[model samples]
Target: MNRSADIMILDLSESSAYKTNLKHIDFCGSPVINKDHWLYWGSRVLSTSEASTSNVLMRVAEQTEFLDDETFETIAGCSKSENYSQRCSRTSLQSRDKLMYIQKEQLGLESEFPQHLLPDGKFNVDGFILACDVSKETVLHSNHVINIAKSIAKTKKPIVIAFTKCDEMSEECKRHYMTLFLATKELKHVLCNLPPVETSAVKNVNVEYLFGSLAMLCLRSQKLVKKPPLAYHEASLFVEQRNLHVKCCFSTLLSQAVPLCVYPKKFLSWKQVLADIDRHPDLMNFVEVFGSRVAFEMYERYVSEAKELWAMNRLRSHVPRLFEVFQVFLGVVDLADMEWNMARDYMRCHPLFSVLFENNDYDLGMWSPSTFNVDEKSRLPAEILLLPEAGNVFEQFRVGRSDGVVAIVNGK
Candidate 1:
């Protein structure tokens, strides 16, 4: 058989397998041979050639079922009068019912269509990827993650656990990783136990390795039918390069920033600074103002100093109440004047300003008191403040108060 001339487009609607056949028409070869019937659409088929173009169109249309009124109207409008698109549409409707009947009798999809077409006109490939986050204090979170993983496992894809922040672990704490590893192994053993599980972390991590593995699986599946792979190494390489560039930019910033005055050794690093912005992609627009160089430097300084201050002073103890006020200040949380009063009442009960201003004696009057100043609305948090006087050391004494006085009352 000549393969080129043998290419056939089969319309299975008229066949006995019409009910059970879910495969695409292109899967059938030229002069398609089936147990129920044969359809020859190859160039060599004189009968197919002799058939009217309208009849050919109608036969082609018969294979697809239209369920909705709009689709029925669309098929009707696309139909040729001589070929009667309506008749083709009717045949499709009937073929669908017959297919359902066959499924009920054999495959057991008794009352419903298990597979539906995507809006983009493709079949849904039953597959899923499990994204697990395993971190300290997040072990119980694994239960929730596993539930989702199990539901998606039914789709027949590999499940992976993303263990975050493992760099903070000590040699003694290494057993925690072992425990997590065993837990994942046991979970898989009890569950599907189908594909080998993979683990990753954003730090000390091959972030794209797991995704690349999944992509390879999808690619191999596609190759069975001579289709292109869903993902290629080039895409992974692009992500890797993008992340490297971002890290380089962040590192350059940290080096230029001055060490934190209070905690010199605890200065912010490029990784921590970038992690903050990475966690919240929305803040990216503000990064442009610092110019790539200045922005990185200032962000490093700000985050480092902030974290140092918070850690040393135990300021986070005040964060819950402070966050309530800060959220309102940041426009995330809203409250009426009375609510503001309530928040102020709460703040007064806490040593918030005292804790924050402990070592820092910058003039509050010189600085903008309100978190939201109308003039500097567009500026970032660090940019809105004035730098302290360079090398200006003040005496550790408070100035005495003096009052203008008239002569003593009795003397006057």
Candidate 2:
């Protein structure tokens, strides 16, 4: 463990599993809001706190105080979307002594590159964010993802791989991943051009240096900015990397991108986007994958619509209200605001998120027993793995030019 700046940093970056320096007595913690659930925490930090050099998880300054509410996360005069308070978590608690830390639940948020990269509003590269829970015993990825990757590979298109969840990763794995990334001809150039630094995701800073080769690969990857389409210059790539907390690091890598056309434009809101997505068939495959956009819309709609969920005589919007009812039920406040809020909902945010979107893989109900299959790894789908000769020079000649650059990353 070392100190970077004024904060004492704990290095949990060892490749080996947790070998205890020592263990302390377990304790229970309560909230200031007079909440139901109590934090049963086991002291993990002994000599020094287990922190990474780039760790944003624990802030010694912030930990000095006890905040029970998002009350401190307020803004003077800004919309919920623009508020820095969104950066502060509500359910999480930070101890003044900094011995225990509350594991964060998902906020139903996603960060994706824009769908229209260039000013022409045409998209070329395919983007995907595959997620795995490191807290789980095994990391699970879908067979469908492998199938899509294989198909993309068969066409001889450009493909990039970035592994996230760096904070949870061991130092050895970080080095290995960095080495692999740098070994790639394109990614090597990207790292060299940009300084290696880390910061909070909400800062929303931008530096234009993907594999700038993304432009050489696609005539469109030319001069670009991370701002929205309106900030786009004529014939330049314009993609607004919107609201994703961790996207500050990952989004810049995709050079050939398509802007969402929904964000950063005052005229278009999430409600309008959601309405358009539902109403028009032509915009169905508007982009290859709409997970991030759909996620953003879902979160916005969920929070905003829940305000009106209790209409006098109407069926409630299941997905959004269910999220609210499942969560706010235990609390005294938000009762008059909620539509018949009376559930014993002390469940974790993840499980509740699963049921709220039943079609998704996570099903705590036991009805959809198989959200992920471990056997999917045996089916290697990349064509190069199957068809490439040991050392055939002619094979290079046979390969087609890269038509697109596709990235598939684990969203852990």
The TM-score values for the models, in the order shown, are 0.23, 0.19
User: What ranges in model 2 sit over 4 Å off?
Assistant: 1-168, 177-213, 216-241, 244-412
> How many Å off is the CA of 248 in candidate 1?
7.8
Tell me which residue pairs clash in candidate 1.
8-30, 19-99
CA error at residue 312 for candidate 2, angstroms: 8.0
Question: What's the distance in Å from true for residue 131, model 1?
Answer: 3.1
Candidate achieving the largest TM-score = 1
TM-score (C-alpha, index-matched) for candidate 2: 0.19
Tens digit per residue, CA lDDT, model 2, 196-230: 22211122121122222222222222233122222
RMSD of each: 22.0, 32.6
Shift in Å, residue 107, candidate 2: 32
